[model samples]
Target: MTETGAAGASESPRPRDSATVMLLRSVAEPAGSGFEVYLLRRASSMAFAPGAHAFPGGGVDRRDVELAPGWTGPSPQVWAQRLGVDTATARALVCAAVRETFEESGVLLAGPSTRELVADTRDEAWERDRRALLDRSLSLAELLARRGLVLRSDLLCPWSRWITPRGQPRRFDTRFFAAALPAGQQARDVGGEADRAAWYAPAAALSAWKRGELPMLPPTMISLRQLAEYTAVTEVLAAHRDLTPIEPELDRVDGRERVLLPDGTTHPLR
Candidate 1:
């Protein structure tokens, strides 16, 4: 496998733990049309995957696992089993997914109680807290405690794990999770690292990618490819998935850089 950097000179960077959320929702479109998935385009000035369409996520913060907010659904121990990690790490990963999703997309996978979800987060106070969460002034557990809310951990389904190719300036060992867009909640352009945010039917997004309009990393495209197969959010959430970790192998075939995987898949470098 090719271990040379993109420039064929630099050494590989160590991968950092991160988590991403695939927010899905059903559209009025017909069957086989597939469900919609939210995506954000990173600002061009960013250091990693700039200008690439991606899901909302980021590196795990040490404080993420410290939150003791009320939680419903599967416990951290259960997540550890599903994510193939220890309980502490699993707790952090799940919290990171929820926190990053809210920070980037303004969608909260939380509620006042397990039976209901927060309908609107457009209040000035909510924005203040969101910013505090992003700026590290507040931990999610602390924020939830102040609001008497609980994280609806049941909303998330562990989907996949993807490690960035070995030779890159920035690499992430990212866990991908899927969640249905909460009812009464809508996504908006929150603008930070990402300049634009929108939702697209999975098939449409794939078509855009093929047309060279929606550029994305291999993992994003692969996740979309999988999502394009399902017609509804329920279908995706209910389907059994193999959550094995996948760290794409880099190789130079016929003098062209490519990403190879054990599943007999290959994607040429852009």
Candidate 2:
């Protein structure tokens, strides 16, 4: 939540619409929690949250708002009701969630039909398509249409929404989503914006952040805290969430500026 070496600006930039997916899987040997979440360490050279551990996501692309790709599972109308957006925007957000997760994690959430998932995506042809998606040369719609696949929107569960605190150099109004890693799909270190990728039990990740071994933004930290309560991925997917947007505010605490979250916790604003 804190931005170092930059003075606060008087006017805040409008937040960009973005989507983030927290990919999870059940762990056989529990380490403080029964499930582990996938996280990527942003390359230090990135402008935003450099070196921080985050989920696989990015800003919604213009193509995401284009004609909808083949889709199954929950309809966009239902998603609009759940995500608090119009049907079109809801579809775009869901498309972005699936596209970003696949681009960053090598795990596709789409399949030939509603009841199936792409078992493996490590083939040479798949990698070529993935690279095209990453570089903006391919659209998710076109990709799905060509391959006779449909996006499995039901694979994703709405978690929460967060807005970057005002006055930062960049900001995003991001919808957080939770999804179980699909069976037979493996998440690998497909580096691009991230320097490394790994899975961590929710509690263990928080412990690492506390020990200064992992740095995270408030949203990621808070989401992990929530996830740590569940013993199974199914429990997380079945849980209902209140999706009111959380935007941190600036407050002066004990002579130092800090970011005040809706829960009243304060993070030092460096």
Candidate 3:
């Protein structure tokens, strides 16, 4: 393996339980409003995708899945059973999503409402945990407990799941979720993982990528394409409200990459 490849292989991004939350909002287009998803540009110091924009997410932790005080969202047992892991892991995945979103974007989904958190910026202490969490000195669950916060599963909705190709040096069995950009909280690239952040309409973003303005992994590209199809955030959430987890397989064809869903449909990578 090349040095870069070797480093990527050891990059601690192994297929540990994880989840990504795609915070979206509706913006009025000149003609009508449509869905706009948020993306973050990784800080140049990062090992992977040093300058690429991505959704908020990271590796799951043991405390994330602890059921002692798990939030009511998806069934932990069901998710664990589906992902072929223990119940605890499933909960951790959800917790990771909530935690990652907050730490990376400086947005809190834990409050009663988005506006509330924005109204009261006194909870900046949670920001300290962002560095500590990545540094492995603290877990998200502990952070929330210390802050008297709860994981607002109700704000999150299931979207899709994707696993890295089996032969890749770094792999992730990632769950993607969709959540409304909370009203009061603003998304910022606070965590060092990302240096900058912005929101974009899926179609507009993909168009720019096509023109070489941005680069996206196959899964994220396709996910954005799918997201661009809806005109309203509510419609998109209603459509996926009862999502049946469908993981796609990646294949190389015609000197290009393709995303092959288990259902037999295939889409070309942009």
Best by TM-score: 2
- Report the C-alpha lDDT of model 1 over 15-72, residue by residue, as the tens digit: 8889999999888767456578999999999999889999999999889866666777
As a whole number from 0 to 100, the lDDT of residue 181 in candidate 2 is: 93
- As for candidate 3, its clashing pairs are 64-92, 65-92, 114-184, 115-184
lDDT tens digits, residues 4-36, model 3? 112233344456567888898878876334878
Give the CA lDDT, 0 to 100, for residue 76 in model 2.
Answer: 97
Error of 1 at 226 (Å): 0.5
Ranking by TM-score: 2, 1, 3
Candidate-wise lDDT, in order: 0.87, 0.90, 0.68
Q: What ranking emerges by lDDT with the best candidate at the front? A: 2, 1, 3
> In model 2, what is the error at residue 15, expressed in angstroms?
0.7
Note each model's CA RMSD in angstroms.
2.4, 2.8, 5.2
Candidate 2 structure quality by residue, lDDT tens digits, 1-270:
443222564578999989999999988854667789999999999999999899999999999998689999999999999999999899999999999999999999999998899999988898999999999999999999999999999999999999988877789999999999999999988899999999999999999998988888878988999998999999999999999999887666445667788787787542
lDDT of model number 3: 0.68
By summed lDDT, the worst window of 10 consecutive residues in model 2 runs over: 1-10
What residue pairs clash in candidate 2, if any at all? none
